[model samples]
Target: MKLKNILIVVNDIELAKKFYHDLFGLEVLLDSDGNVIMTEGLVLQDEKIWCEFVNKDIVHKNNSIELYFEEKDIEAFVEKLEKLYPKVEYVNHLMTYSWGQKVVRFYDLDGNLIEVRTPL
Candidate 1:
């Protein structure tokens, strides 16, 4: 068996699509009604549908998983993120590790954790 796309629940499908595209450059590969498949194998599902399927309350900031992305210019990415989404809650601002890898961690619009780091 092969691993498929990573699915995340979003309260607003259209807003989620635009958020992912604006921040991560992920375009919609397909829009299947309540489900949207985007580039890099990311899937956005409607929150109502997700809750019904899981039969549980949706929790935000669970911190169980994070979608990671690598960028050549992490500083520019962080600036863009701030300019575009000022209200974003950051787990950590851009910081460099001892090994010189810079990373920024923040939550997406729907509370999905995201970490953007400079290429190692």
Candidate 2:
């Protein structure tokens, strides 16, 4: 068995696609109705479709899981994030670990937590 994709529920599929593309350069590989498959095996499913299939309420900012990305220039990434989405809620404003890794955590427009960290 292998992990093929990591799916996340989003309130707005278009906005989620744009968010991932604008920030991390992830392009859509396929768009199947309410489900969109993007580069890096990330899948975006519309909240309505997901809730119907799962028969449960959708939860945002549960803080149970987060999407992580690595960047050599995390500082520039953070700067762009601020410029593009001023209303974005941050989990932290750029912090460096004792091991010299810099990271910043924030919630996307849909309240999906994400962490951008320097490459190890």
Per residue, candidate 1 scores C-alpha lDDT tens digits across 42-106 of 99999999999999999989999999999998888988899999999999999999999999999
TM-score of each: 0.97, 0.97
Off by over 4 Å in 2: none
Candidate 1 similarity to native, TM-score:
0.97
Candidate 2 per-residue C-alpha lDDT over 27-117 given as tens digits, one digit per residue, 9 for 90 to 100? 9999999999999999999999999999999888999999999999988998899998889999999999999999999999988899999
Judged by whole-model lDDT over C-alpha atoms, candidate 2 comes out at 0.95
User: Residue 113, candidate 1: how far off, in angstroms?
Assistant: 0.4
lDDT of each: 0.94, 0.95
The window of 10 residues in a row where model 1 has the poorest summed lDDT is 73-82
